[model samples]
Target: MKLSHLLPALIWLMAGSLCAAPPHSDVRIASPWPAQNTILAMLGYGENIVGTSMVAKKIPLFRQSLPRIDSVPVVSVNSGHELNPEQIISLGTQILFVPSSMTVPQQDLLRQAGVRVLAFDANSLQALTSRVQKTADALGPDAQDKAQRYQHYFDRNVALVKERLKGLPQDQRITLYHSMGNPLTTTGRPSLNQDWMDLAGAKNVAENWFAGKQNRRGEVALEQVVAANPAVIVAMNKRDADAIQTTSQWAQVDAVVHHRVYVNPKGMFWWCRETSEEALQFLWLAKTLYPDRFADVDMRQETRRFYQDFFAITLSDAQISDVLNPPQ
Candidate 1:
């Protein structure tokens, strides 16, 4: 046990320990949506993803490459069975990321299975930023730098929105529809889209009766929209926007006739990747609805800056446009 002899043994042990530490290049993860997958990929952890839910595979980036668990709830599913707890654990995921709508049973199952479940809230722009940082922290040291960068862009983007909306008169604020799905459903007060629209200085008409309701899919008659006469109509997806324009039944609405229709892309899951694409959609909606107030703001350039400063990705104007205006 001479000092020199012990030194070599200690060095050998140290090397083995270093090798034993998990590598950042690969890790098992499960997500409820494709946007989270995209966010992870943007953070340089894309290659690390081992498994994803069916929804995550829809994005072009992961559509072909990832394995589908068929574990996610159908988009039409409003309440229970949204999360397949057994299938999630069967994927052998060390960490599971879920949307904010997780149920009590799902939480119990994850706890029993020893899987770390991180729920992200995309309820508002601020909530989205906090969730992004929390997700980054869960990924350990490899994601530290990327997490800091993500926070930076989030801060910059939100600040600009507040600054732009500060001096707008109440009458100057526009009326918004906050459409979702093929039916062009508007936000019912509790819905995340409604909150975002409010932040952007738009008045959400749907909140009139459905305020604080449990059901987000609350529907109003075409007469309601026609009478409210919103200055602008915000559609969640491109298909929804097109349906409003082409569908005979919807043509009766004032928004369609007035040409106030605005489409927001489904980025990161609009419900969860709250910090990234959802926030971008908010800014885009703000600028689109109130161009005069945000005249100096260039959302495309801002989006590119977000990609560069936060996700470390270089996105061109065409690529950004494609996300904004998906193929019909």
Candidate 2:
């Protein structure tokens, strides 16, 4: 064959091979939700993130987990109600991950700008695991393996907790009241926070009280909380826990009176949320509720292992403690 004829064929073959190659390596992603951002970072796609919301910026561990996170542009829209489509387009984002709560118009705007948008509901354990899988699927084939491993770890941890707490009498289950921030703001039935309480082998005092309500969080009068008199009082952070402890009105509440007030751990994301760290949150909550049953579970070691295995980061003793017990 002539050299000129062979050269054209070779060039065509090269172009075909390049087109067949996967595009995941070049994917530029943006997420306005902190939970989804944490999941993506855990899946080893932190380097692909081109934009983030204000909420993601506030997470110290999230920032620490991704060395290049600061370089990502902030694209929060209307004080977090939506995402900034213009900034996202400007950053060359190929994909945008959002919570299911995002409005249709917000999604439309991004799609019109040529960005593929994925919305996942991470409100329940099932939804959260499914979202993880979906997010991984969007990333590429390599991420599927990570997602499966994560799901297995999550299921195994949950099963371990369940097996250990099997046949626990309902009466013995610790009843907990979750203080959102103030004593009045609390979590109830149908909420992810309540799901955490249930998985931890504890009862939510506000479960039936807010039945049929659309919102997950509601304000319960202080009188009602004192009347319920839960065995444990769980707060999202130390500030709320301290408020519950110091408030004179709650002095007589059983949880406060017995010094059973506890704070949920906060890290890259709130452990209490239905994020990738839910398995750890379940273990922590279970341990806090029934110390005798979970005495063998070293949370510090578990935290270190989860980060190392999933996020590929090794946390120090102090870092683990900070995650398990955040400052006020």
Candidate 3:
């Protein structure tokens, strides 16, 4: 069977603007967004990616499912912080996907060379929906339908989590801390970090600092974190979560004492970020924050379902563990 047959989200995201496309074999692309690469693969355009980014090239799950991922040249470094516009043009990349905040020094150069650079803001849930569409649009009609289906699945799961939490007391929202990249670095402003935390019915402590004036991924002092006294804490890496759990300074923190510090699940990319996996992130976070409220939600089963449904990949129990725990 064709790899396309194995990936059905393609049909779901490819439904709009059937203004047609080149032969499926001809749609070459490059992008600094790691999540965008995973989504393109889901739409059955994996082979067309000739230029990729450093982070996308390193995702373990992405490599396992799409071995060809290893063959794509890394044309952009960290969302174009260091991009090779000449290399992208040389690779014949038709579309380049990036965040609106892109800072590459040669963006004008890419346009001059006839590369269509598409930028979108994916800082919030509302914007994420549009981002997926914008990405799919470049892939042409087939990806548009897949984006719609993914959106429906995402929204439905959000509603399910919301409905399930309705029985909990209004005052039960957990006071939480979410660490990004490192143990103390966390969400600031204009990030989906707040969106999922809010969806999971938790109060993110960082949102209150500097009146929400921090960068999307900013650092907070250990003293500041202690003062927040969050009931739960989540870190982007297992080592950080372990630090919160075992370090002396963090020992007095409520989450550490209560054993609530957790390693965020990461698949194609950290689920806590803009990846399609945020659908599962909200469910997992809600369950972690209030196990009683989500007693019936089996995260293992949910993880298996998400990978199978959206990415068309079947995972072993060990693979599921890797996604949830992620290696240090």
Candidate 4:
């Protein structure tokens, strides 16, 4: 063949290949964020996961729902900020997802090794929904439709809660205290934790407890909690709820006195956190706060349907209970 003729043919072929290829097709992704891992699986990208973090693997829902999860290697200890690009590249990873905390240099290391890097920030509801859509986009066309459906479900429920609580007076809003891992540590100030309370038509006593990005502890003295005296307490677990109930200092708190200490559900990856399951958390809180208003909403049935609809996993009653209480 003539050199000129062969060169033109090759150029045309290369152009066609580039033009026809789907964005992120044949993607092999690894993520250190447990919240992201749960969302990825929910969006039907579980099969593409070649690596994940240890925290994601420990989630009961992942063990039960995603078989590929067991085969995926753990790339980092907690977050993927210090991920080894050589290790990830060797695994044939096309994409690596790190949290917003991941440094630019770390992401650049993977990028230089021919891997795309994506960052997820899941501090707010807006951030969570954006993560869902962006993740679906990265998974190619097949997952886009599923992301849309989930978004619709999320928007519908958010609207329902807003409509139900549209005219709720300030006095009617329940005062809430949400504790995290420890008794004093709560998701204070602006975050999805505070958003949950707002969506549920409740007042958060810890909303202004600790303010600033530098303050990661989110802890307030026990006395401040007693002074606020929340009407309801949403503990990280049943154990925390019990601590508030039985502890002498907490006895005077209104929530403790009224027996309104409820344990937050720990699902795919702590529904209370930035996981896609935050949709359920908002609903659960709405009902928990105003039982009379949301009497028709049953969380157990919603949970079963959510897993079946999104991840195609059917849960037995016992399995559902396991995630809700999640054995101590």
Candidate 5:
């Protein structure tokens, strides 16, 4: 038979098996958030994933681990913000994981379709931890063990970094300018990126200027960055870091002059955001801000171990380098 003709039969068989299993045994999960997918994969629930948002397909680590990911249908509209309820229903998604940014009406639409909606706040470390635990609990009792193990690993790594940097005085911390894809765009106190900087013991220059602003992300003129003259500039990606370094207007900035600009790492997910790899992000940021203090830290080893422990995959040397120094 032609492969096209067999596809419908295959889908029917899979859907039948999914529906035939006990109510909680064959749960089909869909999430618009790549971080939540990463958490599910870490909890050994990758087989339960039936659908995901369009953005999840672009994550290199996710693609590397989940070979069948492309077979899963996307449940969001092209706009990236709106959910496609019809497509979601077609995919037979039982549970939908969404970020807190999702509006009430969107959740209502999914719930009305018999899809249970689980919303998580990924803005802070505590919130991210809670989300992970809650997601594991929803999966089942067996998943709780994996969640606790991950939590233990997270707590231990964070405490280690905290202890190492505890003695440093507040005045001695380095000042950082975090470039959110553009040199002119930066994150302030309201953003989770700011939380990463705080954990790394680096001060965010944008927070001082945008303290009372309602928006977490704000744009400042090139001249403002030159005026702030932060000690270091960290870009979300290599392209952004290169742009900051080459811009003529940034020539006089302290970070540009001193060549203190660096790109944050991109793994299964962007290290700048809340993800299962957050503990590694903290370590990487801390090391970037204070080399001498974290000189003994082996980034390659840490990255390798994180993938092995969390995703149950071992990365090659080239993969490790790619995650740390992604292409521009």
Candidate 6:
């Protein structure tokens, strides 16, 4: 589907007079991360955002105000055909910011087309720091302060999660089933989602069976999932929960019987957007699954604060509840 035509504020952003020393005037950034977009926009580089691949654009700030570009320069399945080199050169993009797993051939193509591509991933504590530094260097000395601030806040979030997870008893820890998509797939042992689950003090049920660096997710038979009987089944969509709830086959699962299913909040961009908001999502999910262990944390207030501080947007209590309480 073409998202470019649905965008409402592209003209307004482009029409605004350019700044004399716009830090990103000469640069064009394409990121799938929501947090990256928030940071770039906050620093007055929103106008410089020529394109976006952010999956969180459905959320309030992005849906209402962000520009949508004609095409994304990357493909998930094949890196070679991710972007057309001729088209990229025509766009006049000086640089492309991508995730670490972006293929070497894609990198070479960008270079050959006179475009610089930098890959980064902030899935772990250490990687987050490196990503900040690299982003700072790319943006020049002017972005140093912002980069440091990003580092400081992200560090605190990670530290807080680590501190909380440290004291949980292994046996008492919740068993999680992270529903990935249409087929109801889940994160396997080696995926980033498993890392987040571990960080949240939960044991991933699919870890032992599937093993791969990329998320080992695929269709999970309903009967099999029920047989495993996880303590918490985190379905990304409320609709999925309803579908499972209605299925006669799921009656055997402990999670279904005990009503222990939860859906992650929308607009928080935990799934697709890579903003610092993600750190907040990790915090929120951990607190949600183990409320007693994290009773002091207020995920709703925290999420609202993140939106206000980073995206310059505010969310209402009702909206927050909608994301937290999803139909079931």
Give the candidate number with the greatest TM-score: 2
lDDT of 5: 0.80
Q: In lDDT terms, which candidate is top?
A: 2
lDDT of 1 by residue, 1-328 (tens): 4544443444444345445545545556767555667667656666556555456656542432333423333222225737655555555455777677664245665555555778776655566566667777878676767777666665666788899889889887888776665554555666566667777788877776575566555667777776777777767676777887788776767788887776665433442224355657667788888788789888778767765665555666776776566553
The weakest ten consecutive residues by lDDT in model 4 span 6-15
lDDT tens digits, residue span 256-318, model 4: 998988888887888889788888888989988898889898888999999899889998999
RMSD score of candidate 3 (Å): 7.9
What C-alpha lDDT, on a 0 to 100 scale, does residue 238 get in candidate 3? 86
* 156-248 per-residue lDDT for model 5 (tens digits): 878878988989999999999988767688878866788778888998888866777765777888788788889999888788899888979
What shift in Å separates residue 137 of candidate 1 from its native position after superposition? Answer: 1.3
Candidate order, TM-score descending: 2, 5, 4, 3, 1, 6
Write candidate 3's Cα lDDT for 66-134 as tens digits. 888788888756543766665666666668877777765566655555567887887787887777777
Which prediction has more favorable TM-score, 2 or 6? 2
Off by over 4 Å in 1: 1-25, 61-79, 82-86, 104-114, 120-122, 248-252, 266-275
lDDT pick, better of 1 and 5: 5
* Between candidates 4 and 5, the TM-score winner: 5
Best of the two (1, 6) by TM-score = 1
Supply candidate 5's per-residue lDDT for 31. Answer: 83
In Å, residue 239's CA in model 2 sits off its true spot by: 0.9
The candidate, 2 or 6, that scores higher on lDDT is 2
Model 3: runs farther than 4 Å from truth? 1-21, 77-82, 104-109, 167-170, 212-216
